[model samples]
Target: MSFNNLKSSIGQALQGLSESVSQKTQEMASTWPAYAQVQQRLAQEKLGQITDISQMPREYIDLEDRIDNLQNSIQVLLHVTRVYEEPAYDWPYSTQESVQDWSRAIGSRVQELSRASSASEAGNLLKSPVGPENGPRTLNYALSQASLAVSTLTSSNMPGPNGEGLSSGLIAYSDTQAKLAQIRIAQDTQVQTKFNKQLREILNNPIAKANKYRKDVQYKRVLYDIARTNLQNARPEKEASLRVEMETLEDQFAQITEEATIVMQETLSNTHLLKNVAELAEIQKNYYKQSLELMNDLMPVFNTAKGDDEDFEIDAKKDPLAAKKVVDDDE
Candidate 1:
């Protein structure tokens, strides 16, 4: 850069710095009196000596209290509802095996079984049962493992005449349970997206902005009060200027108080909160309704198995010798 340009740039920088300092000084000077007045007012309030202070409207005060209660309730809801954010809360346990390892293990086992010529050979190919130690610790996962184990044993001629039927029933049960687990996860996702997300937006945006306005109203109120006190105590020569200052402060305070009141009212009347709550209820309702339907569909299988067991028990009770003969033949 040329010398003249360099000097001009330096001069401009110095001017900007000087201007910034002056602006900051003015801001501090303007705020210091209000800060001092607020401290004095607080001291007097603590000492029970504040007699003629300005009071906020009763409606405004009531709205403020309601907003406070709403914020508190939202905080509590968020505390519990945060569990929806975690996909694994229902089945928190993790296996030591990676996804690839689990997949390969199952694939190799299936391949070995496919090559077996007979049920006896397939049974021999079957290894020890895989369980929660190698998979998620969920009821559906456990049921699936149980189904696999029963199928293995049934194929080996260990369970006898009813083996195939039992295996088929267990597989159906496990499949239905897996579907129910997916539905549950869907419900959690809906709650997180519709309910929890709305609550956080309300708390962070409108509620937060309203709270900031309330603080500004309070600061302006203190400044107004201090200006009024100064005006009252002013000498005759300074009375005119102090009265003007008092009125300006009063106007500023009133404006902010009105704005804060409007914000609080709007926050309280937010219909989105109602909609969010209804969404949560709807999510829960659908989850329960679907689960009930799935369970009811499997009820006949359970009842049939139970009825067969009951008939066998009744026959055993009616003729102990015949039951013993059957048992001996099976053995």
Candidate 2:
């Protein structure tokens, strides 16, 4: 062949290759990778609609329980404040026992109403049965009412020891308790969001997906080989088809391994991201420990040595100071 004809043929071949490459690039850019897209969409949906309270981290659940106990503590303190600080000389029931009894009855009434509401469907379940999804809203309403009632008492000052308002102690205690509850609720939400984000990331991780596909392809190759070997005795045509499938699996495994290797290398190269992940783990651990400690403190049985609920009760039979005097006499 002439040199000129050979050069022209080479030029045409190069141009055709270039055009084919361009077309393939355009198709790749325009079309979404179906598997990757579907996985990403699933992760997004998981992050967006993760409302199941049972799925909340243990630390967050502990914090919520602590907040509830703290609110109860505030209510008990409020009753103590009203009964002990304010003088009720003109009132019919003046003794500590009578006042405490009245306060206990009111508390029982509140509990009974709460229990009645909880027995209904709306109170029992939110969007799901196991989630306790509506608990926060119901509890919030109850807390708000109690806070408002305490605020009402503080709206007007009264004569008391050191010229303080009779309601001053209750007001301060309730306000602080409310603020604590609010902060804890906010923290619970933030932690839940963080958990969801982490879950989504893990579910959609490219490296993880690549490794999973690699394993699947490897397993398929083994089965395909067994199939081809079995068919070799009976059917050449079927065996040929099995060999083709096996070749496809081999190619897929090769591609997946290369992609996984690159992802792993890239991940290793990102020192800052690795450092941030480590730091996040440390922070999460410490925060969980602290939250658990706080929750343990809030439990009613925390101080078993302190005494039971009845320990604080004033004896009706003996003189009020008789027990203390016995201690004093022993001393």
Candidate 3:
């Protein structure tokens, strides 16, 4: 071919390729909003599964009950490690010794708070605000209620995220921060702060704190009485063995609870991230040009499809042709 002719052909080919790319780009731009919607919906659904932390879990309840059952029985061991109680009968005990070990256990939890982890832990806490066993309430309701609960504890020093109280204010992101910052705020600032503010105040109060001490003393006396009677009714070796078992169990519970709490904290943090990821998707949605006609809440309607066991099986008895398609009535 001549030089000019060849050059003209190449130019035409380039033009056609550019046009194809432009058309493909336009197609993607038109449909990308659906991508954002799916992301938002999935994130919201997962955030809904974030563990409810506001009312504590049944596992914690069971642990607390177990502790209560122990009472003053081993008040000496509450804060002490096995090192202190080793060799079984080594430690001295007295009814007058008294008991109140919540200080150490709760303090350990507080100390473990990695602002990042705790926020995530707390973020999932409000996933359910109605009864414990239900689908999620709205994110707005869960967060607003958390703010309100925190507000009840606001003081001049701890006036919440802003200097205003939690109930009266919202701790919103003015501008989206880095992922790490978001996690920190959710766990440490929001959830952990609220729990600590309430818990610490009670722990500090003279009268309120006294009640725990009183409860401890009462339980201790009962334990002391039991031990005394056991000395009379049972062998010294068996009584000693029982004390060893109780001490071991208490230590095990504390260790397990601590680890479990860390898992809960991480879940809570991720839950917050889940919601934020959804919200971020919504923000991205604004980037797309969605017409008024395209805007609707279709997710709820889509969830109505269901199947019973019978629905899975072929119902050929009702209609012979229902499950079978005859291309032609051949033979």
Candidate 3 least-lDDT 10 residues: 291-300
* Winner of 2 and 3 under lDDT: 2
How well does model 1 score by local distance difference test? 0.77
Q: Write the per-residue lDDT of candidate 3 for residues 1-331, one digit (tens) a residue.
A: 9999999999999999999999999999986864554454446545884222123357655544543443332333323322212221221331112122244544444554544366667555434232221211223233434454554555344543333422233222111112222332233333223333333343344223334443443333333333344444777668787666545544544454455445433333332323433443453343232311121221112123222211133344654443232222242
Q: Could you tell me the TM-score of candidate 3?
A: 0.18
Model 1: lowest-lDDT 10 consecutive positions: 305-314
- The best-first sequence of candidates by TM-score reads 1, 2, 3
Q: What is the C-alpha lDDT of each candidate?
A: 0.77, 0.45, 0.39
TM-score, one value per model: 0.67, 0.33, 0.18
Model 2 stretches with alpha carbons more than 4 Å out: 1-166, 215-219, 234-331
Best by TM-score: 1
Select the stronger candidate by lDDT from 1 and 2.
Answer: 1
RMSD of 2: 22.0
Off by over 4 Å in 3: 1-235, 273-277, 280-288, 293-331
Per-model tally of clashing residue pairs:
0, 0, 11
RMSDs, each prediction? 11.0, 22.0, 40.0
- Tell me the lDDT of model 1 at 1: 100
| lDDT string, candidate 1, 1-331, tens digits | 9999999999999999999999999999998876887988978877988776799999999989998988888889889988888755665443423454577777877887888999888887775564224444455555666677766776576454466566666777877877776787788889998889889989999899889999998888877887888888899999999999999989999999999999999988873556777788999999999987787566456535532133223354565544555576599
Q: How far is candidate 1 from the true structure (C-alpha RMSD, Å)?
A: 11.0
